[model samples]
Target: MSETWFITDEQAAQQALEAWREATVVSAFQAHQALDDTGYIEAVETVIADPATTEKTRRAWNMAQEFRRMSPTVLELAAALELTAAQVDELFEYALTIEA
Candidate 1:
C-alpha cells in the first residue's frame, strides 16, 4: 500500500510567511518596547537631524522604522516571497475583496 500527501506551492508559501511574521514581528515588537523605554524616539530624531551618526545608532533607527512599516498586504507578502497571484490567492482568499 502507498500513501500520498499533496501540498501546493501556495500552501507552502503561506505557511512560511505565517511563521516568518510570528518570529520577526514578535521579537521586533519586544525590541521596540525596550528601545522605547530608553528615549529611543529622541535618539532617532537626533540621528535624523545629524548627517554623521554612529553605525550602531543608525542601524537601530532603521530597524525601528522598518518595524513601524511592517503592515504587509497579501500582494506585498507574495511578492516578497516570489509567489504567484494564484498561489497568493489560494492562501489569501480575502485578497479578492481588494481586487474589486
Candidate 2:
C-alpha cells in the first residue's frame, strides 16, 4: 500500500523530471557512465528484440511492447489511461518517464 498525500509541489515535480531525463543519456552511453558488461549486453538484446517504445523511455526498457511501442508517450499511455500526454507529463514526465 502507498501512503496518500495531497500535495501540489510543481517545482518538485519538475526537478524529478530533470533527474529522469538525465538517466536517459546515461543508459544509452551518450552521456554519463555506461552500464557494466553483462547489463550492457542484456540491454542491447532487449532493444534489438523490440526496438519500439515510447521515444522518451525507449532507452531504459529492453524493448517497447509490440503494440504499445508504436507510439510511446504520455499521450499513448494517456490513451490507455484515458488522459492526455500534456496532462500526464507534468506529473510523470521526467527522464524516468521513459522507464515507466
- lDDT by candidate, in order shown: 0.45, 0.37
lDDT of 2 by residue, 3-99 (tens): 9987578978987665654443222222111222213434434443554544455443433332211234323333544444443333322322333
Off by over 4 Å in 2: 1-7, 14-33, 37-40, 46-100
Model 1, position 5, has a per-residue lDDT of: 98
TM, every model: 0.27, 0.22
* Alpha-carbon RMSD, each predicted model: 13.8, 12.9
* Candidate 1 error regions (>4 Å): 26-100
Clashing pairs in 2: 17-94, 20-95, 20-96, 21-95, 54-72, 57-98
